[model samples]
Target: MISGVLISTLKAQQASVLQLRNWRTLNLRRTVVSPRIAHLRHRHLRQKSIPVAANIISEFRKANVRCTPSGEKIFKQAYAKAPANTFSCSWELYSPLWTTIRGEDTPDSLCYRNLNVSSARQWRSRQAYDICISFKVYKVWEALYTNSNIFRQLIDDQEKDCRDFSRCCMALQPLWLWLKLVVKEGLVERGDVDQLPEPSMLRDVVIGSGDPPDAVDLGLVNPAMCH
Candidate 1:
């Protein structure tokens, strides 16, 4: 009876040891697997941002804005102004520079228009606004492309903002139609119109009962707006 009892006790101890070994193996595997998963996620994000970065660069280039070495210098200088982690990407840090350039009353103010001289004269052309704004927003993307850590966050932010921009443009459907008519009829000057057609102008053309909303082609609003 004593010998039987000893054998059973030894068997139980061996089983416990085997169970512990299996648990440790699983833990080791998880530790190794977790990092591999994270690396793959990072790679996917980088791949996605590459094209986005290229598109952004192309947009700026259309406006004759260069984002190579000079832009890099500007980016680094501006980066110091923002607090740590305040900006997800360097582009966010560099955005203020573009805005500052826009507000300044310098030759470069119209420089955004230099991309196409003819388009510059046409304030009614949505392309002009897009070209100009692209130049302004280029610095942020340029910086983002240079930094991998922040680039992932930038892709997420841009995706979310894209939806917002689309929604906002859609909500302005009524105004969009009005602007089209204004542009078509030349009521709004092709040049010299710095902002949206005056609210009063929109009210007069659409609400005055002289012309119905259907009179204007909504397709003229440039589906995306000048974002």
Candidate 2:
């Protein structure tokens, strides 16, 4: 009778252990697997909602700015690594501006000399008006290379707070001036546009209110070329 009792006890213990194991497996599926699956599904939906622009990619190709398959892959990888809230700038404004960089391959001396003369001419035209601040924005070219970190930092800074028109333009002017300085100083090279922000992104910072700053009516663009 003792042997029979021992056998029954052993059976009961094995059953209990097996039951506990099953419960644990089910619990893990519920707590871990399900949440992971849901997260993946959410990511997929977000990606689907934000489609990459085919036309912009095509324009890059047209400009002889084609990325290698690996490079394209890395670009996508970078995008994936960025936070979901990261801002993407517009290609329409960016493309036209980049295309205007005609002399990126020219020597620094020649570029600087031309810009100097141009600045002088503009300055003379505006000598009658009191200059509030010397605001300048330079064209971004494929040749003027900056690292991705600069663009990332700029976007991060812009997103930290909402900007109105004057605030937005003020933010952009400094960055644009810096980009020109970077190129003129030969800190970057031809086709080194790794850090170039999209024009749309620039626009967002410069005119966040979807309108021009208060000075626009004062002939900010022409302003006697200064006004």
Candidate 3:
């Protein structure tokens, strides 16, 4: 009985020491997780670029510029005048104004893929959206694209695609700015975009339903989509 008691006392002492060590180490683990935290932050940053692009597009919506609807008509018009074998003016002038590009490019500087029928149609659709945003933003500020310095540098490349274009816009401005601007301009109203619903008429009006009511409605995103 005496031996067992001594052994038990020793074990208890060891266990107490272990527990103390664990307690002390917990703080170190929490403090030293910088790498993991940084990785998580990078992942979050990568995830955020799309919404930022979308928001930048939305910002131009309020500027109320001349926007042509994306459909056969606008596509045909832009296509009809597309520079054949590297001619310029009129249509190409419209291209820079609406493409949000720094300047026009020659065949070598700006190369466009000859997408198949469906892909070409899709490309036109995307270009229409770009045009709408660009026109509005341009009208709001004649230097709208020039403000996006990255875009200014990209015009010379001519090989950039939709992904590159969208990514460039995302890098220009944080998406949160778009949400805030709509609220400020009274275009979006309140609650639907910010924190929570309040006990008032505006609450019911803005936040019709759902958590984080202000969340951007992305509508049927494809895994391969860059938009």
Candidate 4:
């Protein structure tokens, strides 16, 4: 087991790298006020704030900080802040720095960029799974109408409450799904799971332990043992 001091230190480090911010300063969400469906294209590329949260949540999962619910909450909050039309309304065309949860640069954040862990689960999109099973609104913004400017304001101006930022991220469910498959294929790793101490079973015990809670690729075993 990791010592208490180490855990604290690790958490502190993660906190410094994994943060949410008030992105409500500049006006990213600009439109002519028309109901044009074509206007809302691949919204993620257009807005920096929502993706900023998306990147943060991906980092959290890499860190393994109960990100499923956390991601869901942040999505809901962000959705509340966005305008009533398509979610692509916000645009932080200038900001390049992505902040951490504790309000610092995210250079130290974990990188499970590939999504390789089969044992892990990701937050389902509001459109996919019922929120009843999902965690409570990370904050009130979770339930906000997608068309509200509040959703856009939170990302361009200031950091909405942690939960509020989470709300906006709800729209990025597909991104998480892609990560899951990529991680499972050994393309990426979650920081939390990777950072976890080796299981007691792996220490001195032989292979062939009972089934792991999550699927493990049997091929990873030593070739000599498989025969």
Best by TM-score: 1
Rank list by lDDT: 1, 2, 3, 4
* Model 4 misplaced regions, further than 4 Å: 1-39, 42-44, 47-59, 62-219
- Write down the lDDT of every candidate, Cα atoms only: 0.42, 0.41, 0.35, 0.34
Better of 1 and 3 by lDDT: 1
Model 1 lDDT per residue over 1-227, tens place: 57988999999999999999999999999998999999999998775554333433343344233444433333344333544543445344335445533343322233323544455255556766555433323323333333334443554454444455543332133322222222222222233233323423422245545332222222214433423
C-alpha-based local distance difference test score of model 2 = 0.41
* Per-residue alpha-carbon lDDT of candidate 3 for residues 94-193, written as tens digits (9 for 90 to 100): 3422342223221111112423323433434655644433333322332222233332333223213223443333212322222222222223212222
The best candidate by lDDT is 1
In model 1, state the lDDT of residue 79.
Answer: 36
Q: Model 2: per-residue lDDT, tens digit, 32-69?
A: 88888999999988765662333223434443344444
In lDDT terms, how accurate is model 3?
0.35
How far is 32's C-alpha from truth in model 1 (Å)? 5.5
Say which prediction, candidate 3 or candidate 4, comes out ahead on TM-score.
Answer: 3
Least well predicted 10-residue stretch by lDDT in candidate 1:
211-220
Against the correct fold, how does model 1 do in TM-score? Answer: 0.32
Q: State the weakest 10-residue window (summed lDDT) of model 3.
A: 103-112
- Clash counts for the predictions, in order: 2, 6, 4, 52
1-227 in candidate 4: lDDT tens per residue? 89999999999887766542223222223233332434565454365545444543444343333344433443344433433343232333112111112343233232344223233544345433224212212211221212234433543332332234443333233322233322322222234334444333222445566343111121122334434
All candidates' TM-scores? 0.32, 0.30, 0.23, 0.18
